[model samples]
Target: MRKISRGGARQGPGWFARRWTAFWMRFSGPGPVGKLASRLAAWLAPPHMDQISLAYLNRRGYIDATATIYHSDLRLGQNVYLGPGVLVVETKGGGPISLGDRAEIHMHVLFETGRGGYMEIGPETGIHPGCQLKAYVKPIIIGRGVMIAANVALYSYDHGLAPDISICDQPLVAKGPITIQDDAWIGTGAVILSGVTIGEGAVVGAGAVVTKDIPAGGIAAGNPARIIKYRNELKNADKINE
Candidate 1:
């Protein structure tokens, strides 16, 4: 694979492509300008596969010519944008992959599902470039209005850690699925593990390794992701002062 520089790192062209896609997405909603922008985006970056027709996706949204997708069950909603070099591939015993309306999957982002695993992305959710979501034995469900920054990784399965077993021979296992609730913000380089639920309106700081559930409206950072504060806490404090 060819290497590209992004954000002072070796991340691929995801960030650059996302910037353009997002700019175009702004006007892809409703109205005359939106229609024009939608048409322009479709013309410039149509879906690259014969599996999805130009006419079908043109009415929906834009998909970059460089993107590669191969799934037996793939569902895309209105105004969805898939940026450059995005890849969605099915592995062993894969399941369905669904993207809600206005979902934006940026450049070089990868979605891999296997072992009856699946992925469900809600409306208006934006997943930045260089991010990866791999599901196995469970589903990765991301709710509406979620913002996942670049290089974030969500894995719903892990290898067994038995000491006597060889690393390669160990079976895959999962505590549970990964669920990110509505309006959550996941910062760059975050790693979300299996069995984790990030509640609605929560904020996860950059580079955090989340292993547990983050309550709704909570702000969390650091490894294991402890709640630093809750948004309601600030609101309560303001009411007290008043």
Candidate 2:
């Protein structure tokens, strides 16, 4: 009978042969032992390339098997979750991309950063599936506890269309940072352009194209989103009636 080697080879065991035999016996069997063997094999097996790359981002975070993260300066906090098909890319010389603790990025979300541009999502923020976030010259900041619905687009740069140059060739321009303050609710299909701030506790309606800042506790909805009501004001009115 051929002796099983330490490295799973068919050869006579040399040094530390007893240790290898004991280790194999502990993890070899049919029921519970089979389960332990499977787990050990998985743990010892080499991870995929994407998994290896994401390990540099955050050891504590959970990245889906289908997610693709290109070479980037990624800083992910503890308990951060990246869903399947999520694509995160950093252009050459782009700034760091950060996701705070408990930030949940849903499936098929795309995050891109251009040269010198950064993107940050604060703690406990949940970005729904199919969202696109791009930062060219300025930062895109999503504050803590923000809830962003599916298919939303947030851009921190706009293309310049000079009559002298083609629109596609025109240099990207940034008015300022795109800031979505804490506890804000962004509805589905909303497009938030650069230089706009969605204030704390504000709500943006679906399909709105936000151009200007929405005040705190304001509710805005439209093609060019306009403040229709303030949540604090509504609460005050309700108290007066009571």
Candidate 3:
């Protein structure tokens, strides 16, 4: 028996050569030489189970090779994709987290569920890189076709501030669930708080802290996000002037 060190000359060179030969042989037309090369490659390195082939991967979702998923109840629909470096976890025996069909979670995203909390992402939703969704005591529901830009944060609970208690020691509280309705667009670095509903077809400006509910078809911005304009209203006004 022989021991092989990590990234050693023997292993590295041999591994690369085998892979290159395998690729060349596989691409070449079927023949005795190709068959022999393919068999050798198979013996050297067997194919690992991919997203479509693995039952666990399919059940949870199409997770990237580099993604980290912790022990949690996850229900994912067909064609859901999780990019590299994504993290999904459930702490304190929380409820199941679900993602609908064709949901795409990009690189470095995180989904965390706290005690008795759950999170749901609707069909065709695309979450960009570095986004986080934390459900501490309530649900965080994102509706269909929602586009969440990079560095967004959605929190379904807030830390309570009591006079006698430290911030860290205080319990987390939530007035209600955080909901982002269908076809909404959340700009980069937006922070959505608990009890807030970003209505259907609404637009949230970049770096906005949403603390209140936005009306349907509204455009909101700034801290404690206020409705700067209504989409339908603006359209109607433009039509009248024209």
Candidate 4:
């Protein structure tokens, strides 16, 4: 038997873990240390530190802010960072969207699901701002260490209409589960449709609309994403557009 390639498995120097650790370290600093760090972080290049604090509070192993939780029966693990205005909804769903520890969710992201459907996000993953994730009747599993860029839309189920049947009249059915394997990078503005699986280590190009499953280590692009290259094995390695 041959060993299957675990391309999407989280490897390297634990970049995300390091950042999370640093956040805690700063918080545990001297009496005035945490505030100073926040000021400095704000002064530094990038987004504000206040946003980071809210995110850290929402999902951190150090503190469980369960009582302030706006939703009941929603599972949030330790060290999971959820920024301000992060909304998780089970409006018509029977289950919940369980988030793993150390997951970073940016501000203004919307998560909604329908009956018996679920959306599960793994640990140390970054869910960027303005992402809309809707699961209807089919579960969506986002693997560990996944990097989802801003404004990404992911739907695990879609409406179906046969030639003989009217789409508006017939009950909506889920195409299938949408599985985003570990270590995958979903570029900014990328849209992943129903029944699509982004394989391990796969890279989805920005503004691309994925209509099907992308193979492991694959780099896909275009309106309806098409395999353009493979990070693990490909002849045109140097020709990688990215």
What's the CA RMSD for each of the models?
12.0, 12.2, 12.1, 12.7
Alpha carbon lDDT at 230, candidate 4: 85
| lDDT string, candidate 3, 67-165, tens digits | 677845888787676665788888995778888987888878999998868998999899998999999889999999999999999999998989999
Clashing pairs in 3: none
Q: lDDT for model 4, on a 0 to 1 scale?
A: 0.72
Ranking by lDDT: 1, 2, 3, 4
Lowest-sum lDDT 10-residue window in model 2:
49-58
For all predicted structures, in order, the TM-scores are 0.75, 0.73, 0.73, 0.70
Query: Which run of 10 residues does model 3 get worst, by summed lDDT?
Result: 49-58
Q: Which is superior by lDDT, 1 or 4? A: 1
Query: Candidate 2 or 3, higher TM-score?
Result: 2
Residue-level lDDT of model 2, residues 1-242, one tens digit each, is 97665677534343344344334334432235433442343243234322232322333555654667784588888767676688999887678889998788887999999876899899989998899999989999999999999999999999898899987799989889999999999999999999999999999999999999999999999989999989876755476557
| Candidate 1 backbone clash number | 0
- Candidate number with greatest TM-score: 1
* Model 1 per-residue lDDT tens digits across residues 158-199: 999899999999999999999999999999999999999999
- Go through the candidates in order and give the clash count of each: 0, 0, 0, 8
Clashing residue pairs, candidate 4? 59-79, 59-80, 60-79, 60-80, 61-78, 61-79, 79-102, 93-114
Model number with the top lDDT: 1
